[model samples]
Target: MKTETGTPILWTAADAAAATNGRLPARLPAESSRAEWQATGVSIDSRTVQPGDLFVALRGPNFDGHAFVADALAKGAVAALVSAVPAGLPADAPLLLVEDTLAGLEDLGRVARLNFRGKVIAVTGSVGKTGTKEALKQCLEALGPTYATAGSFNNHWGVPLSLARLPADHAFGIFELGMNHAGEIAALTRMVKPDVAIITTVEAVHLEFFANVEGIADAKAEIFEGMTTAGTAVLNRDNPHFGRLLAAARTQGLGQVWSFGRHDQADARLLDCSLHATSSLVTADIRGERVTYTLSLPGQHHVMNSLGVLLCVKAAGGDVAVAARQFSQIQPIKGRGLRKRVPLTKGSLTLIDESYNASPVAMAAAAAVLGKADPGAGGRRIAVLGDMRELGVQSPSLHAGLAEPLRLAGTDLVYCCGPNMKHLFDRLPAALRGRWTESSAELAPLVAAAVRAGDVVMVKGSAGSRMSLVVEALLALDQSSRAGSAVAALSGS
Candidate 1:
């Protein structure tokens, strides 16, 4: 495993000061020289600061990061970026003094992009943004040193942080852009200025803020704001909003637009797919060449997203055949579709952890993947679901709408939680309803108790729904069972 000690020095005091337009303390410690100070990495959290990290003290409404500047410095940080010095720190400490730490971080990101000479790609969508971004990263890594947004850090602060951390010599950079309201992507994209922009697909996500799906599509289209007529735009041809997105890209003066989907006219077209419980075999035509590969991730959603990844690789001048071959190495990210087997007293059961987040479209797609799995002998397919938040007035109907998909998935039993998911529970047939509760805390134990050997279980919901609690409870069963076995052996001895 790679450790912080192995990381190369990423920033120097002189370069950082020039990038952020920040100033060093008037008088540094006698032993400390500006040219001698270096940071191996950048961090925002004091708790996770490494020995040579440059920590940025960001202030928020509920918490002031200035209070942790001393703590970060004590934890081996080379220096801290601060709007104002903390009470305990000396005026001559190794610090980057800026007007505002957040803006300073953004400035560092802007300058980093300006100095970078590599090909950059930005991805945005209601769903599949992170998955597609990760896929692109995996493919691009085979060709050169690649930098990508960590996890799902694609927000206002996350994008800038990812950019600021971009190494000066990387060959490629992939970024994920997300939004809950209008114009968010526009600001982030202008900072990115990607050479290739991709919209995996737009759906009824973040409807709580938008008037409808069209508005969401328009918000996603803001990713084009940073690109000029020379750059390429990648769209999902199978999506209903494809025409809208295509028009928007044209309006933004993008000179080239490439599309990926199962549609006949798609530039990167999926010709066929053999979906399995944990992986799939896909054959697609990129431009005019036929390419086939195996994807380790389950679900048709991922297969479709893979097409977009190829288009990005081609647009960025990467070897299409090499990128296509890297698909087999890509695995499912945690809480998205990560699958594990839990050992019970007599046997084991499969657990698909999709608890990180949820949406109507994502929920339906997950159900489709579950339907493809072949449960063990006497095992049944089960679902434990919580609410899909941020749906506005359609929350009730959207929750209830999941009943059809779950039923079609051949789910034998279900555990439901949250008020919105109660709609789905009530809509389910009596024989299919295992339990229902007002919260995941209340539902976790019930589902954990009811699950048995020979069961294929899936737990999923929005982050706010805290469905991960239920997943934790289910996993804890294995630990308790092992403890009991140990106790029995000790008694016998």
Candidate 2:
């Protein structure tokens, strides 16, 4: 891929101003000596400004980018996009002032999306949005040049920033859109106007903000509000709300609606599935033809999700086999399900890092996968759980209810943290509650001490609970040991 020069290359300043609704300041430099200069890239952070890159001086709630205009200029930024003039910038520096930095970013994203020549796929869900987006990016990239949103950049600011930074000539683009409030998706989707939209599954997430699960469903369905008339909407047939989503798509006048799940009549149906310790072999009836493949990632849920990805690839005008083959390279994202091997004094151990975010639905699924985990030779299944937040008035009962599934899944020991999780801790059979802590930080040491060779440790919690901290603490122990060569001699000849 060609790299964009980090310089202010304006095709037409008038067009830029028009796109942003003429909020630009008059005193700023408008005419340039050269008409065809190169823009290296766009950035919100002035510290990363490169030569010719346009520095977007956005005003954040805490810090103002305008404060860093001098830094951006010193770092070789050719122009600064701002809502207000800063104190230290030179009078001659080019400035594209707008009513708001965030809004300006949206306008720039809209313009970039409109000018691009590639197919765009937008993904959203209560869960699996990031994982599925990563999967689609992996699959789609194999067929042609592809661009995808980096990390979990699927928010109000992230969506626009991703779209604005898109390279003009890329072959394909994938974006993940997320929201917990009404109208949020509508606003973000309007900018991308995706060629294909994938709704992974609607679940009870962000329940604190919603009146009920149906409200969350309505909010998620807003992804179709800005979809192009000819675009396709990929839905999950396994989700109970599939019918509602289907009707929503129809109301939006979407030309195609594809479904994926275990249902026999789904557009992309899972005919059979075999889950192993680290991967799953799946046979699916995709549009009538039976195709079988091995998923590099474990979990039956992932196998079902892959159907959505395959259908989306076809919708995006790419070859299905090309995309399917790319699955071999897909791995779970961190805090989602990325597994690791840690060397302990007793022996090497396996850790399932699902500390990213959790809901009751997802937690149950993770427990099931943990139940089937390969303990190597003598390992036990250890589940380290934290609070699953935002269940509304049913929080306590819902928390306690997890005990049944954990027991059914044959979890050998359960280590729990957080107040809400205490309910589950109390409800568990005394033998199953291995340890409990008021905070994840305090529980980290107990977990490390209890882990044995071949044991599979699954850590999970909602984002608000910060369960990733415990995951980091456990992984860091391995690094500290490695640094001291504590385990090197044990395995040596």
Candidate 3:
């Protein structure tokens, strides 16, 4: 039997050498202790380095992490994983020298997977990968010890970093694999070789890299490349690309596949869903077994994805009942869909933070959530939106496409920012239009000053748009005196 602990082991020099096929460079700092060379976990950024962590200095085309090796050490890093020693470091610095730091990180990840005696699950899709990955982590953790990718760490570097940090003793490991171009997921999935792979859904995200949605679907199907021979592929049967994704998975020799959705053909079928303003209660039939669970997350997309989460749990031979019960503990990830109230003077305002990445599909989902929000007696539903990037030549059309969804949501007012969103701003009716600006930086102050009591403000944008600034500015309003604030609630229509 394996033992799991929240505290990591001292990843000793010998252990790292064996895992990564690297060795400590000669140069013993006189003040360094033996433990200084042993890492408890692996980190890439100097600013986020934890005391006992091995700071992996990954070099990119723009910036070099090697430049921060000393800063990482000063932040209490146990060792620095570097391809080349930097200037001014002690002769005996806790350095695990490698031929290539990236390759070394991959090697360590491979070793971690080799030593892991637990079920490994991989999640991929156009959207909701992080949310689904998080749901699984929460579910599996309730059943037993589990590890999952942190935040949206689902890229080439993030995958290896998360895997290399996997504890030897755990019941489950969940990884989120994301890619824009083809062949990316193939390489990552092969490294993970998950026992179960899930494609949450296929959408028009990352259209900048592919010629069409089919091309994006094909690229997403690459996650099947890493499935074990006996692995199960959990798919979204309701998605338009479900047939294409299912065919791709079957071609890869994944015979056991479970289709999850509200459709009749779905193995994990939705029986019923009681939707709420802030949460949902869903009853699902998992391959003939019926179970009901309360998901604290809002949006129909999340409810649909929870079926996939339960499917993954059942596929991993876990107790579905136990896992389903854990759904209540699932909280909205910050900037993803977290709900909070900013204390105002007379009354508080509801804040829905969706200021993370966005796409056409994601924007619709966010709008749907905003629609269902039960604003206060005098409150109004407001959307603070920034540009959604990476649509290539279709950026303007896609941006303009959001107008109908906003109308359907009965948004009392709309605040638009960024050049791409101007197309949508022009299409809005004068009654619903609040303001429009070329940039979120300029729009943030105006939106912040406009928010008032009984208002539910939902902010969203692409990663490059920096709409979080608008979210920050609105949150800052909560800090001001609630009484007689500049923001006044819109008069009842």
Candidate 4:
């Protein structure tokens, strides 16, 4: 069905009500004919609701989405899905009443998956899931209408929300599944039921919750639980847990297991690659055919993940050549290796914002990118790092271990924050130490002040560490300096 705007209708009131076992608004008659009333999209946040969206009022520990029902309607939401009737809404407000809003969302997602007539792929790993999912989306969209999870929406609620947003006529669907503990992926994967599953590579992330990396591998292996016997499992060949994940996938009855890496026996094997500061040139034997492409995003991690993405495209019967060609168009998103120049008085300082999240492996990758960067004349490589969270008892040692990578990266100056980061700061050479603070808030200004016009600064930390504060501080420097110059000019005039 299409709306008057020629947009494809995503859901009808009748179909949605039946899908979620919800009751229509009281004002509507039991058999009222409202087939013409349809939604063009689905949204969970009231602030982002579009004109013809079905806004699901999800509840969380700190907040209830029901409170925003009226606001969502005012902002053009066609109807609000709520478990309880919110007070202060108009008498004729459109609402779909359900026993539980979250369960209702799950129902919508399950029904959508059941109705979709397309190939589905699920991605899960300690890192690179979002990048791989986004890459696949770009490659598949070149062939036909493709739907994928937005950003890193791969949790329990996030997965269902992404699934519920799937358009009815998409040719391919990709979902990223993430877990901090065992059984989380099992629950999410069952809902996705992807035909192909990709485990990018498991690492020592979220180690606080598990006994060791092996436990993390077992938890990641749960991505195979929802697959049928005929599905394909894509494993990372070079990772230490490859055998464990492969065994689990086979035991779960997956029909095909494909591997990608520099290893000799990898199905999608890397033939050659050059990692530059902002891009990578790669030649790989994908399945059987040798393909070469220049990926715009740098780093070996990205290079390896690209092989998995192309293998997925081929596994789903997409044109490998076309998919390989699409790699050049991909760029890094913000807080994920996005590079920009901030104007200073003499020259501009390069800023690499990797402040979104961090783990040991991710930190090393970011540092490698920093190592390749070309600092301006008389400039130096600088790293402003925050704590890598959830490392448990290994947190201190792991934190200190980062010293080697930073030193090898030729980092001229280093600023560290958080209690865990103190270990790393102490490990750095005396000449490389810029400052160490108990928190990022205290560390931000010092790093911002120390950056010179010719320097290149990279800020990175876990989400909980609030390392973005340092990036914000560094960015604000340009504006403040410009303001000061303007004021001086006005005074002279």
Candidate 5:
């Protein structure tokens, strides 16, 4: 997708140096003007650098990108952005020096955003930020060209990097903003200045850094800091802090505010929803119009999140009908409700990969999706959950509370990892407690052994717990099984 304006060609060596405040070791050759350069793209990673790209050497926590400057240059980076010139770089190489490469990259991104003329949508929440953002991208892409943050790139560096990467001719832009502390979203949102801001929902996430849920809500509200004066603010009417968040939007002088949920007054209200084995049929009242559609993805939480996307698309000057029809193409992202098939001796199995990240609220939602999963024949519902991190003193209670939902959802088996998850394990009925381990690595083997044909296995956990490793191990077994079959075929031949 192209940005609304043609990509601004800031290709002159002089312009690059000016962007970084004359931080270059030497001015670019006088003859090298914008007309002489043609950039295919830009990148911060040396490994992914393409020919004629500008490489940004940022210093990360564990590794310094400056170390890869030579490799990037050798791989065809036309220029480099660094805090200092490399030890032995040629004098003729284009080098833009700055006080901090990361900051300079952000500044360049800001400049790029200033030149972008398309509508921008910013998404954030304690959970579902990535899923909701992807949904919005899917819907908006149907109407015209669109640009969205790649994967879960919604943090400080990620936001700027995504913005900077925005092509100059896209009709729409979608960005996801995430934060764990106060003022982080405020700073990032300012850089985005979204035309329509969506708060998926606020929950007791990252409580380790806050005194209470209200504090978390305050942090999420900071997303409005960069909203345009006439922008639209989309909030979840079902959330307890809806009024508070609404007030925050008003204080920022938002021209329009839309609510999505089952609330009667919600601008986008859920009229009826029927959960199926794989997906949900949702009928919603969008500004008083009754519209029914089936989401290709599972989970009622996803349906709820889609309402925000619908309102956002309308706010961004897109056709609601076209956007609504695009839902069929929507699929769950990796480690976030993405399903896979595993072959077993008796039959095939279904694996729901929700191992990306989790919280108490998200755990309950996932368990509900797992409970509703349909096993074709003689199959059972299974849940493999890890600790919901950052719950502060409430970690034990919150973890234990999931047992009730697990039971209510009729999950046949519950496998848990992490010390915090032990609280839930203790609370589960003995019949449902399939397995438990102190770590995901130790638990993955037991899970692989337990999963059988006709079983719907759903795996979930916080990112820090490395629950995705369990998913990887399970998939590895599937791959190995396939490899063995191929070997047998060759031997038989």
Candidate 6:
């Protein structure tokens, strides 16, 4: 939100001094001393620190951000908020000595929320939280000035950082809260205290931290921990855990419980949804109101989550009709459903990049999208997949379970990577098996070689699997091809 145009004044040096009770440098560094001195931006990573921004030095187990205080100052950071000063820092480096930078960030976030007189929405789930948050951001932006969490900043550190960046004039704020264990969502929700809370869907994700899927559901239900007294809880009724989630919300004294999904009983229900290669046409009944919209993002999962988004728009007193139309403009996010046309010899190759993160439910959903896409005349639908980590002892079964979705998708070839994926590769028919490798880096070349003109390829895996390397390699191949074409054109060939 720290642009030249928008209101980005979260705090100034004087303001931060008052907020944290810290002291400024006795001597001003003449270069940027007169550069407004506003803490217009907040960044933890010194690498991304901008001029005149406040850098919070956060200490972690591996690398302490305080170690980079000098680096941040050199990168044009106007001030530093730190618990401890690093050796060799200049005497003129502006500083805010807080007891703990994490706690300080949370304090600033609370201050931002206290002053924000807008609809605050919190989104969480085992899957689709990023997609839902992004689509909802577009919807709310269409309705009014909106501020949403950047990317999937939905963790212990990310949530507070996002909240602290919120401008006071924002009409809407969307926070994505993610967790891998119990009590994580509870704590984040307490900080968010959303006016509209959305639990996208509870699944067998992060089962390594819980005893069972029900335990995961219980942890997801903790999103209601800090709901506003009159807030609404939006859920996916089609999910089996809907009953339990509803009960939990009711127990929290939430009066308005709107469920969005394929179930006919859902308050915000999908009446009909037609999934296309890169988009979907959806008709839904939202709070007894019938509506239809075209969603630019593919897959039924997005359609279901869009219903929840539209309902949340209405709950937040936004223009549901206008917000619903915004769906058509919502494009796929990078490493989620980002689609690209990679230049090839005969034609162009279609690449669907779901390399950011994955779970069983998400993988099945992506595969379904592949099933629906036409591979064109001579092209084949190829899935370049990798491991879905953190499924606990059920990792093998879960990996093997993807075979059915792949088979049903009519996938012409499958190139899998990672140790857990070996189980899936073993289950695949010989004709369907493209190749298998112990790591994605090793499989990247094989996948690149298998891709042909007009082929549709999808790459997906968890962060641990590093499937993004494959995505990058493919993109680079396309770029090199483009350069070659430019050279040919220059030679009049």
- Which wins on lDDT, candidate 1 or candidate 5? 1
Better of 3 and 5 by lDDT: 3
TM-score of each: 0.97, 0.91, 0.94, 0.97, 0.94, 0.95
Candidate 4 per-residue lDDT, tens place, 68-151, comes to 999998998888889989999876678889999999999999988998889999999999888899999989989889999998
Residue 317 in candidate 6 has what lDDT?
96
Per-residue lDDT tens digits for candidate 1, residues 1-493, read: 1235666566788888988899887654575664356887788989888888889999988888889988898898889898988897865567998999999999988988998899999999988888899999999999999999999999989999999888878899999999999999999999999999999889988899999999999999999999989999999999999999999999999999999998999999999999998899999999998999999998899999999999999999999999999999988888988888998876878999999999999999989888888788888899999999899999999999999999889999989999999999999999999999999999999998988888999999999999999999989989977887899899994
C-alpha lDDT values of all predictions: 0.91, 0.84, 0.89, 0.91, 0.86, 0.88
RMSD of each: 2.1, 3.3, 3.9, 1.7, 2.7, 2.4
Which tens-of-lDDT digit does each residue in 34-86 have in candidate 3?
A: 53455677999998999878889999998899999999999998888899999
Residue 401, model 2, lDDT: 88
- Runs of candidate 5 exceeding 4 Å displacement: 1-14, 23-36, 483-493
Cα lDDT tens digits, model 2, 1-493, are 3335442343244555666774444453465432223455677888767776767788778999888988887887756778888876666666777878788878888998998899999999998899899999898888887889989889988898888778777789999999878889999999888999999999888888898888888888899988878999999998999999999999999999999998866999888889987888888877765777788988877888999999998889988877787887788888999999988655778889999889998898899889888786788999999998878887888889898889888999999999999999999998898888888988988887777788899999988788887788778768766765755677682
Candidate 3: 10-residue stretch with minimal lDDT: 484-493
Ranking by lDDT: 4, 1, 3, 6, 5, 2
Point out where model 3 deviates above 4 Å.
Answer: 1-6, 26-36, 482-493
Better by TM-score, candidate 6 or 2: 6
Residue pairs with colliding backbones in model 4 are none
User: What stretches of model 4 exceed 4 Å from their correct place?
Assistant: 27-36, 491-493
Clashing pairs in 1: none
* lDDT of candidate model 2 versus the reference: 0.84
Worst 10 residues of 2 by lDDT: 28-37
